[model samples]
Every structure is written in C-alpha cells, then in structure tokens.
Target: MVSVTENTEQKIIDAACKVFIQKGMDGARMQEIADEADINKALLHYYFRSKSKLFDRVFVEIFSDIVKLLGEEINHSTEIIELIERMVNNYIHLIRERPFVPDFVLHELNRHPQLIVQQIHQYGMDFSKFQLLIDEGVLNNKIHYIQPVHLIVNVLSMCIFPFVAKPIIMGFMLNGDEAKYNQFIDERAGHVVSFIKSSLLINNPE
Candidate 1:
C-alpha cells in the first residue's frame, strides 16, 4: 500500500508538471496548480512550501532522468556506436511517449541556465568516457580527429531538433498530419545513427 504522503506527493508533482508545461515557470500560478491537484493551496504549501521549491523538484527529477539517459551512462560504455544507437532509440521512444518533456525542459533552461549546470555538477557527470571513445576511434583510424564535444552536440542536436520543432514542422511542413509527423519522428533515430556512422567510418587503404 502506498503511503499517504507518497500518493499526495505524486499528485502534486503530476499537477505541477502539467501546470508548468502549460504556463511555464514565470506564468504558472500556485493556485492553479493546487486546483489541478484537487487540493487546497495550504496543502500544496505543506507539501512543497513554495512554487519555486516545487518547480525545482519537478525540473530536477525530469532533468536528471534525461541526463542519465542522454549524457552520463551512454558515455561510460565501451561500445560507443552501439551505445549511441541505443540511446537514440530509447530517447526517441521516450519522447514519443512524453512529447511535452523536451519543450518543458527547454523553456526552463532558457529561464535559468545555471540550474541545469548546477544539476549536472551535482550529479557528478564527466564526459571523459566520451572523450576516450573519440580518442580510441581516431587512433584506430575508425574516425577522423575531431572534438568529441562537437560530435556529441551534433548528434544531440540532430536527435532533439525535430522534436523541439515538431509544432512548426507538423503545421507547415507536414500539413498537420499527425501520422506523417509521428512517422517522421520515428525515422529520425535510424537516420541519425546512419549519418554518424557515415561520418565516422574509416576510409579503405590502397
């Protein structure tokens, strides 16, 4: 059986996520969140104390999940290509299920970049594994000598931009066909992997 606090905390978090997604941090109202949670504002305060505190918890939880999937763990694996492919596939699958997450994060990051940086440091993440992978690939002649950060940024940009721009892409480009829009997003993972492989593959020696 779930504890009362656990149940109420989840309800508050869920309600806050929706409210933040809809109104953004600046525009979100405490009363609106309380109403959405079906609880009074006093209870909301008893649980979270302040809107900023609640927002921090929500953002940290969501951001930590994304960082774990996209940043920290992927770099720790030796099979860099396989890791990238898996991360892309998993991330696309998750975004398909929770499409609002990316936009919500971006909105908050725009409002407070330091929060993200602080959370990343707090999690003790280092990209050294990714750097080592790049070094190994270069030494083995499997990839050209380029900065790993650039490669990572490119890969992440390719994977994330479509989702970020989904509204405009679906409206203007796909004529608002939800099926076509989803299909396009579903195809992006494979397309991104293929592009990376093509860029990284070694040339045959004569």
Candidate 2:
C-alpha cells in the first residue's frame, strides 16, 4: 500500500544511499543518483533541494539504523562470551558489506557530535542494564574485574578499529589485495572474540 509520492521519495533515498556509500558526500553527484534512481535531475532536486540535503537525509538514517541495530543487539544476556562473539561477528559483517559506513560516520560525527547526543535523547538509550550485567559477571567471578566503560571501549576498539583504518590495513598488511584484506577482516572477528574471552576469563588453579 505505497503511494507513488512516498515510493518515489524512497527510490531517491535508496539511490542516494548507494552513491553516498560509494563516494561519500564530496564525490556523490545528483545527476548520478538521479540516473541510478531512473529519475531526472530536476525531479531529484525537487525532492531534495541539494546534494547536501540529500546527504543529510541519508546520514541521519544511517545513524538511526546503527543506533537501532546496537539497541537491538546489546540486550543483556547471561551468556557474556557468546554475546561478545556475536557482537564482533555482526559488526565485521555489517562493515564488510557497507565498507564505507565506518569512516563516513566517523567523519560526519567529528563535524556534528551533537547529533549523536540528540539521537541518544530521542531514543532514551539505556546502558544501566548492560552495566548491571557486567557487575554481576565480576561479582560471580565469571570474568576479571573490569569497568563497564573499559570493557565496552575495548570491545568496540577491537571490532571497529580495523574497519576504520581499512585503507592503511589493506595497504600495509594485505599489500593492497582487497580479497586478502576481506579475508583478514573476516578472520579477525573470531580472533577478537577469543582474545576478549582469554583476557576476561580467569583460570582457577587446581
């Protein structure tokens, strides 16, 4: 039950997203997006006043999608190790598919950090539950004592740093071979999970 107007708007948004992901804001052209959407540039401009406006729309949705994704996945579960594994794997897969989202988001975030605060307020994000889970794990001797913030930072760094530094990583480590770099990213997910587990889990001597 989609109206033609809404459908056309969505088509424009979809085409814009692809172009933005490929070339980012500076390089994305309205005519290119129009061609991709099979619409005329004039019609595209009618829907979105300018490329910046289109980019803003796409960027905001990307942020919202990421926020929703994190909110959905970070539900507190008893199986902390499994959760870590899932988190790492999910992020790597997502970044691999997009390949441009990580750097693009960070670049935009540097320009508009307040946008994140605004969305946080809008979403009423809750970290208290996850904090409680970490506290319980420490008390139960399930993992080494660590602050929730530190643990979160560590996990995110492991999951995100490689993707953020993809060009350098690929250039230096994989010798600019995209397939090799992709394989490295894929394998790094499991390695990160195991690395976190090893660091957090305490061994009791017999």
Candidate 3:
C-alpha cells in the first residue's frame, strides 16, 4: 500500500544510499543520484534541496534501524550470552544487507562524531539492561567478571571490523573471490559468538 509519492521518495533514498556508498558524500553528484533513481534532476532537487540533505536522510534511515535493533537486543535478551549471539548475528546480517553502511558510518564518525552521538542519544538507547545481564552472569558464576563497557566494545569491534575492512579482507584473505568472501562473512557471526563466549564463560569448551 505504498503511495506513489512514498514509493518515489523511497526510490530516491535508495538511489542516494547506493551513490553515497560508492562515491561517498564528497564525490556523489545530485544528477548521478537522479539518474540512478531514474528521475529527473528537477524532481530530485525538488524532493531534496541538496546533496547534504539527501545524504543526511540516507544516513539517518540506516543508522536509525541499527540503533533500533541494538536497543531491542539490549532490552529483550535475558542472558548476556544470548545477547552476544543475537547481537553478532543481527549486526552482521544488517551490515551484509547494507554493505555500504559500515564504511559510511565510520567516515561520518570521523567527520561528524557529535552528530552520531546526538542521534544515539536521541534514540534513547540504554545500556543499563546490558550491564545488569553481565553483573547477573558474574554473580551466578556463569561467566567471568568483566566490565560491560569492555565486553560491549569488544563485541561491537568484532562485528564491525570485518565489514569495515571488507575490501582488504577480501583481497588479502580470500584472494578477491567474492563467493569465499561472502562465505567468510556468513561464518563470522558464529566465530564471533564463540570467541566472546569463550572469553566470558567459565565452562566454555571452545
């Protein structure tokens, strides 16, 4: 039940995301985005006043989904290990679906760190539940004592680094074979989950 206007807007947004991922904000042109969307430049400009505005739209659209997913995972998971597994699997799938997201966000992080921080704050993401899970695990002797910050950062780094460094990883590790690279990415979630569990759980066999 997508209206024509909504569909057109989504088309523009999707086109903009692709161009931004490929050329980044500095190199992407409005006309190119219009061409990608199969729309006239005038219509594109009418919808989005400028490239920066369009870029912001794309970033917010993608980042908001990521923040939402993370917030849900933190809120709903009862155990730290379950949270870790869900986070790794979900995060990896998200990045794989939006392959340009990690690089775009990383670039923006360096360029507009404050803006990213503001968006996360606006999302109202609370880590108290995550920390509580960690503390509970430690108290129950199910996992080793570790700061939630460290664990959170470690898990995030592991999940994001592969996608952020995709080109290098694919070239160096998989000899630029796209199929094997994808397979590596597919297997990465389980590897990350196992690694984190091994580090945190006292009875981890792997």
Candidate 4:
C-alpha cells in the first residue's frame, strides 16, 4: 500500500514535469503545477518548498538519466559498438515514449548552461574511461589523436542535434511532413554509428 504522502509526492513530480516542459523553468507557475496535478497549491508546497527546489529535482533527475545513458560505462565497455547500438535504440524508444523530454531539457540547458556541469560533477561522472579507447585507437593508427572530449562531443552532437533541431529541419528542410521527419530521425541513429565507425576505422596507407 502506498502512503498518501508518497502518492502526493509522485503526483506533484509528474505535474512539475508537465508544467516545466510546457512553460519552462522561468515561465512555470506553482499554481499551474498545482492545477496540472489536480492538487491545491498548499499541497504542492508541502511536497516541494519552492519552485526552484522542485525544478532542481527534475533537472537533476533528467540530467542524471542522460549522463547515465551516455557516460563512460558505454564509452569504456569492450563491446562499445554494441553499447552504442543499444543506446541509440533505447534512446529512440525513450523519445517515442516522452517526446517532450528532449525539448524540455534543451530549453533548460540553454537557460542554465552551468547547471549541466554542476550536475555532472554532482553525479561524479567523468569521461576518463574513454581515455584507454582513444589511446588504443590512436596507437593502432585507427584514429587521429584527438581529445576524448572532442570525440564525445562529436558523437553526442550527432546523436542529439537532429532531434534538437527537428522543428527547424522539418519546417524548412522537410516541409513539415511528420512521417518524413520521423524517417529522418530514424535514419540518424544508423548514420551516427556509420559516421563514427568511418571516422575511427583505419585504412592502410600504401
């Protein structure tokens, strides 16, 4: 049996997510969140003392999930290609289930860039695990000796930027055909992998 407090807390969190996505952090109102949760403002306050606190909770949760999905574990794993494949697939599924999450996260990130680095440190996330992978690739002459951060940024940009820029791409590039937009996103996953592989795989010079 769930306690009333637990249930109410969850309702508040859910409502906060919706309101944050729709109105952004600055624009969202406690009253709007309360109405969305179908609860009174006092109850909302009881669960979350302030809007900033509530937004921090949501931001941390969302940021942690994204980092976990894209962190060193995936970069350091022996089966990195397989890990990348699974991540792409899983991310796509998650996007399908929560289409608003990407836009919401990006909006918050634009509003508060430092929050991302702060959250990364708070989560104890470091990309050093990729150091070995990068070193091995360069040693074997498989890839250029570029900083791992650059590689990470490249891969993440390739994976996430399409979704982030979907509206512009669809509106101008694809003329706003919903199906075509989806197809473009679907193709991006494989294209990202292919691009990474091509960039990393070595060719013997004569």
Candidate 5:
C-alpha cells in the first residue's frame, strides 16, 4: 500500500513530466503543473519548492527509470541474445508509453550535460556484468567477438533512433499513417532481435 504522501508526490511528478515535455522547462509554469496535477498551487509547492526543482526531480526520475530497466535486464538474463531481446522489447515499450521522454531528455541532456552525468554517476550504472555475458558467449562460441560498449551502443541506437526520428520516419517513410507506423514499431523488436542474432550468433536459425 502506498502512503498518501507518496501517492501525491507521484501525481505531481507525473503531471510535471507531461507538462515539462510539452512546454519545456522555460515555457512551463508552476500553476500549470499544479492544475495538471489536479491540485492547488500551495499543495504543489509543498511537494516542490520551485519549477526548477520540480523539473530536476522529473528529469532524474525519467533517467533513473531507464537505468533501472537496463540494470534489471542485465541481472535477470543468462544469455547474451536473451538480454538483447529483453532490452530491445522493453526499451521500445517504455518509449511508447512515454513518447515525450526521449525528446525532453535529449533537450535537457544538451542543455545540462553535467546534470545528466551526475545522475549517471549517482546511479552507479555498472556494465561489467553485461560485458561478462558477452565474454561468456564468445568463449562458448555462441556469439562473435564484440566489445560490450559497442554492443550496448548498437542496441541503444537501434531501440531509440526510431522513436527519436519519428517525424521523418513516420511522416515520409510511413506516409504519415500513424497506424502503419505503429505496426512498424510494434514489429521492430523482432526485427532487431533477428538482426542482432544473425550478425552475432554463429549458426543462428532464422
């Protein structure tokens, strides 16, 4: 059971995420966020002192969610292919659920690289386990030799690029058809998994 305070704080954060994504930090107002949260300005202020503070909180939470997802996937999967599949699928779903996140995060990252770097340090994102998995696969002749950083970057780029380039891909490539574009995105995980397996895994069955 969640406490009232926790619930209210989450409500504020959720509202803030939406507002910040739409209007951005410069355009968003505190009263607007309070209204979006369905709470009075005083109550919103009780939870967050200022718009800057609230934006920081929202940014940290969103970034933390991604880091946590990666950490969880790394811990749970035993095989390199399994980890890639899980990460690709879940990452796509996450972006779908919060479509505003990638754009907002990218903007913030450009403006405040230091803040994002601090969050990464705070989270202590360890990729050594993922590296070990890759090493194991290589030793067992399951996959080709690849550095963990390259693997990680490749997977992230494939997972995130579609969403980040939604306008071009959806507008031009998809003919501005949202339904078709959605279907494309929905089928993307399988495509990505297959591509990775075919490229990396020896004798991988199509």
Candidate 6:
C-alpha cells in the first residue's frame, strides 16, 4: 500500500506532468497544478519549492526515466537475442504503463531539448555496455554485424511509434476497441523480437 505522503507526491507529479505537457513550461502554472492535484499551492510549493523545481522534476521523470530504464534492462541481458527481446518487451511495457510519457516528452521537447542533453550528461549514460554486447555477438559469429544505433532505433521506433500514434492506431486499426488495442500492444514485443531476430539470425552459420 502506498503511504499518504508517497501518494500525495505521486499525485503532484502526475498533475504536473499533465499540465506541463498540455501547457508547456512557459504556460504551466503552479496554482493550476495545485488545483489539478487538489492540493493547496502552499503545499505544492512546500513539496517542490517553485514552478521551475516542479517542472524540472516532471521533465527529468518523463525524459530521463526512459534512458535509465534502457540502461538497466540492456545491461542485464545474457545474450544478443535476449538483449533485443528485453529491450522490446521492456519498452513496450513502459509505454503501456505510462502512455502519456511519449507525448509528454515529445511535446515538451521542442521547447527544451537542452534539458535532455543535460540529463544524459548527468546520468553518465554509457551505451558501451550494450555496444560491447553487440560487438561480442559479431565477434562470436552469433548474430549479423549491425550498428548499435540501427538496433536502438529499431527497438525504439517499434516500441514508441504505437504510443505516439495511439489515437490513430486505436481509432482506425483497433476500431476504438481498447481491449483489442491492448492485445495488439501485448503481442507487439514478441512480434518485434521475432522480426528482428529473423532478419539477423538467419545469417548465422549455425
């Protein structure tokens, strides 16, 4: 069970995320967030100090969290196929858990792309580990030679495009059946992994 303080904090964060995405940093107001969260402005200020601090928290969360998730999931893989599988599954689930995240990051990004670069620097994001895994796959003759960026883009595009285009996909493709839409999303990770592996693994000499 979530504690009251933790719940309140999360409420604040969620409200702030919505407001920031809807209004951008320039238009979002602390009182509006407080109203949305159903908390007084003083309490919101007590938790976040200022609108700059609140926006910073929400920005880091919506943007930096994915970078962190990718690092953790990719770093833990036992093999190249597992790495690809994990990336697809993990990212799809992340989007499922927080559908607004992609829109929030993309919409807010045009205003503050610099903040993303700062988060990357702050996190010391080392793709070298993931790169090393891919390099080993090539060296061991397990998977076809491919650039990390290509694979990264592949995984991200397959995982994120659905969420970015959710309304159209859910409306037209799924015909507004949310359950069917979720099922399609549920099946996507496996299909993506299979598609990638089929393209790459067929070249293996084994």
Which pairs clash inside model 2?
none
Per model, how many backbone clashes are there? 0, 0, 0, 0, 0, 0
* Top candidate, metric lDDT: 5
| lDDT assessment of candidate 4 | 0.74
**Clash list (residue pairs), candidate 5:** none
Candidate 2 lDDT for residue 183: 86
Candidate structures ordered by TM-score, highest first? 3, 5, 1, 2, 4, 6
lDDT of each: 0.80, 0.78, 0.85, 0.74, 0.86, 0.82
Report the lDDT tens digits of candidate 3 across residue range 48-153: 8877788888878767878889999988899999999999999998788877778887887788676586686689879888889989998999999888888888
**Cα TM-score per model:** 0.88, 0.87, 0.90, 0.83, 0.89, 0.82
All predictions: root-mean-square deviation over Cα? 3.2, 3.3, 2.3, 3.7, 2.5, 3.1
Mark the 10 consecutive residues where model 3 has the least summed lDDT.
Answer: 1-10
What would the C-alpha RMSD of candidate 2 be, to one decimal place? 3.3
Positional deviation of residue 184's Cα in model 2 after best superposition, in angstroms:
1.2
Measured on C-alpha atoms, candidate 3 has an lDDT of: 0.85
At residue 43, what lDDT does model 6 achieve? 90
Name the runs in model 5 displaced over 4 angstroms: 1-8
lDDT, residue 76, model 4: 46
Candidate 3 — which pairs collide? none
Candidate achieving higher TM-score, 3 or 4: 3
Off by over 4 Å in 4: 1-6, 79-89, 204-206
Best by TM-score: 3
The CA lDDT at 187 in model 3 is 91
Cα lDDT tens digits, model 1, 12-94, are 89888888877889989999999988889899889988889999988887788788776645655686677677767877887
Model 4 / residue 24 / CA error / Å: 0.8
Q: For candidate 4, lDDT tens digit of each residue in 1-206?
A: 11244577887887888788777899899999999788899987787888889998877776677677666446547544454566666676556566777888988888888778877666675656567667766776766666878776776666666776778889999988989998988787777777777666677332
Runs of candidate 1 exceeding 4 Å displacement: 1-6, 203-206
